[model samples]
Target chain A: MNKKRIAIDMDDVMTDAIGRFIELYQQEFQEDLSDLRLPGRNLTNTVPPERLEAIKQYPHQPNFFKDLEPIAGSLEVVEQLHQRYEIFITTAALEFEHSFTPKYNWLKKHLPFITWKNIVFCGDKSIIRADYLLDDLDRNLKTFTGTGLLFTAPHNAHVTGYTRLNNWQEVAAYFLH
Target chain B: MNKKRIAIDMDDVMTDAIGRFIELYQQEFQEDLSDLRLPGRNLTNTVPPERLEAIKQYPHQPNFFKDLEPIAGSLEVVEQLHQRYEIFITTAALEFEHSFTPKYNWLKKHLPFITWKNIVFCGDKSIIRADYLLDDLDRNLKTFTGTGLLFTAPHNAHVTGYTRLNNWQEVAAYFLH
Candidate 1:
């Protein structure tokens, strides 16, 4: 049987971006983001307008994506998934052009098991062709024609329709079965 | 109705890679390649053993892809197609990791009309899902599930199966009809 091509998101799916971004927000302003993850709407409303502009630039900052720690159990679970599925890291990196090299490097360093050839640095998720897309953003999953598996992230706490894989363990459970 | 997504190759289709590679071959080996473009052959057979090693390094060389001239009439023709169809540039750049920045920069410089969001830097062609694919390599076009249009390059002179597009003008005529 042909292996299912699985397109996995990089930011919140593979890395603890929310956890790190909150840490950064705290360091930059000394104010804890207590309710940004709470279900509502509009990501910009999560922070003050002044800090929102600065926070938007965080993904482009040098070493931001490079130094990020992996989402817990993602390494092992993804490696296992890689063996059975044709896994591709389909990431939206156009907004953060500077994040391209660092994100690529981070993937190379951390997820060494996945083929470098399978990594896709794309601007739009709508162009991705896969059997299943595991992402954290509702914007990405919303228009996807294939199976959309929302890998739970703080930003998408209240999304509907797509099956939610709460974590890497959930991902393994969903696919492995 | 949803517009058909058209996938186009980067090297010989957009930029004059065939001419540039030939020029590089002469400068590096001081000899003309007689018949490397002939049917049923390997690309390495075009040069001597030593130069084959050098040729392998050509794609990774600085400014190799960045300095290439756009194919005659490609910019206008692609722009026309882009308006009617969802055009995505599916390029194989993983083999030449260093070529990523230059290739992306070259696209941005020359094909400013094409959205940055539509550009796809990928290693394999089989991953692309589109209604039509315009590529120069027989290897890539051969495996594509879509309607592959062979964008003529010297290397694929004798391959068969896909419809042949000798130039961008021919590409325009094919889709415009």
Candidate 2:
């Protein structure tokens, strides 16, 4: 039997991109973002209007995604999942052009088990073909033909309807257990 | 009604990568390759064995894919196809990691009509989802779930089984007409 294939999103699902954004915001404006979580929205509201452009340029910077820490339990759970399933690191890397090399390097450094052959850097997630897609964006999941597993992020706390995996441990429980 | 999607390959189907290889070979060794068409095989057979390493490095060069001219009539035919079909430029770009930026820039420069959202930089074509895939490699087509249209490239001249599109005009005839 063919092993089930899973297309995994990178940004917030695999790595803490928002956490990095929060870190950048704190370093730039010296503001504590303790109460920044807003349901059904991203941290954009927390960012000052005057500094919005600077926040936008963060992803465009070289090595922006290089040193990002993977989401809690993601590295271990995803590595275990790789043993049983054909997992692809399907990231919408085209949105930030400079993220291509850095993201590829980050994967190589952190998730060494994933071969370059299984890494896809694309724009739209709709063209992906897999048994399941684990993404933070409902927009991506809505267009997918396969089963969509909503990977919870602060921005999508209010979003519902799909099977939600709140964390990498939940992902492991849903798939492995 | 949802429009049928067609995933198109880049290297040989849309641009003449092998032709560029031939030009580079002639310039490097100063040998006229006028009779180099080996029919079933690629121009690699024509290159001296000692120079094979150099030939392999061509794709790794920073601007290798930047200035590659599109195949005759490809620009026109693909642009026309975009009007009716949800077209995506799906390329195995990870094989040459340096090719990401150049390939993306190349598409942006020549195929401005095709948005960045429609472009995909991937390694394996098997992960692609669409109604049809137009590619030169039989391996890619074999693994694809969609109908495969074998775009005639010199290396794949002997390859048969899928519907063959010898040129852009043939592609237009197959799809548009």
Whole-model lDDT per candidate: 0.80, 0.87
A-chain TM-score of every model: 0.90, 0.93
Q: Please list the residue runs of candidate 1 whose C-alpha ends up more than 4 Å from where it truly belongs after superposition.
A: A30-43, B26-42
On residues A4-99, what C-alpha lDDT tens digit does candidate 1 reach at each position? 989999887887666667788889889887565565533497888877778877777766776678889998998999889989988876566667
Candidate 2 lDDT at A70 equals 85
lDDT of 2 at A104: 88
Residue-by-residue lDDT tens digits, candidate 2, B84-161: 999999999888888888888889888998887888888888999999999999999999998999998777888879
Tens-digit lDDT track of model 2 for A66-153: 7898888999999999999999989998888889888888889989989888989988899999999999999999999999999998
Off by over 4 Å in 2: A34-41, B34-38
TM-scores for chain B, listed for all candidates: 0.88, 0.94
Considering every candidate listed, which one attains the maximal lDDT?
A: 2
Worst 10 residues of 2 chain A by lDDT: A34-43
* Cα lDDT over the full model 1: 0.80
